[model samples]
Target: FASGVDFHSATAVDMFPHVRAAVDSGEVLLEWDGKNGTPPKPLVKDKYASERRKAKTLNFSIVYGKTVQGLSKDWGVSLGEAQELLDKWYSARPEVLEWQ
Candidate 1:
């Protein structure tokens, strides 16, 4: 299950090379650590790594038609937090946002 999430997350990033490059270059900071090479360190560290993970999950959930209330309950966050995460995702991925 964990690996599946990681794969999905990695694949999601792969679909957006520009976004991944931004993350790698420190121009953007998403939940997961950006893989550099032999030594793997998060491109940008955050105290709320878990929260960020949840945010990423919520992003996928939204794409799958999950509702704000469902995401809040599933991720154990407030409705506002779930909404904020979605908002941040769309803001960062303007191409996807525009497509939607």
Candidate 2:
């Protein structure tokens, strides 16, 4: 059960603190479904909610080796917007970018 737990253990131990600090300082908000009673509530409403969601989708797509043109079509954003979003994400998560 819960495969990949070992694979991610190092990241959980090392990088989670940084992520938690960002959440605590209001620099980022964590959101998830509450159906399972875990992460039972939404974080603060972001003013740029739509843009953030698009950026998040692009981030995940990048992790899966998606190209910019594919991400543009998948997110229904222009190529420029997708590229900009990716740039911002890479800047924000340089460590993750390096690992990728």
RMSD of each: 8.2, 8.5
The residue-by-residue lDDT of candidate 1 on 1-100, one tens digit each, is 3443443344345435554675677664445433554324343224234444544665678678787788778878899987865665666556765666
Each model's TM-score, in the order given? Answer: 0.45, 0.47
Best by TM-score: 2
Q: Alpha carbon lDDT of residue 21, candidate 1?
A: 73
Which RMSD does model 2 reach against the true structure? Answer: 8.5
Alpha-carbon local distance difference test for all models: 0.56, 0.53
Given candidate 1, what's the lDDT at residue 54?
48
Q: Can you write out model 2's per-residue Cα lDDT over 1-100, one digit (the tens) per residue? A: 1342221222222224554455567664454345667453334223334444544455567789887788678868899976765675566557776777
Query: For model 2, what is the alpha-carbon lDDT of residue 24?
Result: 66
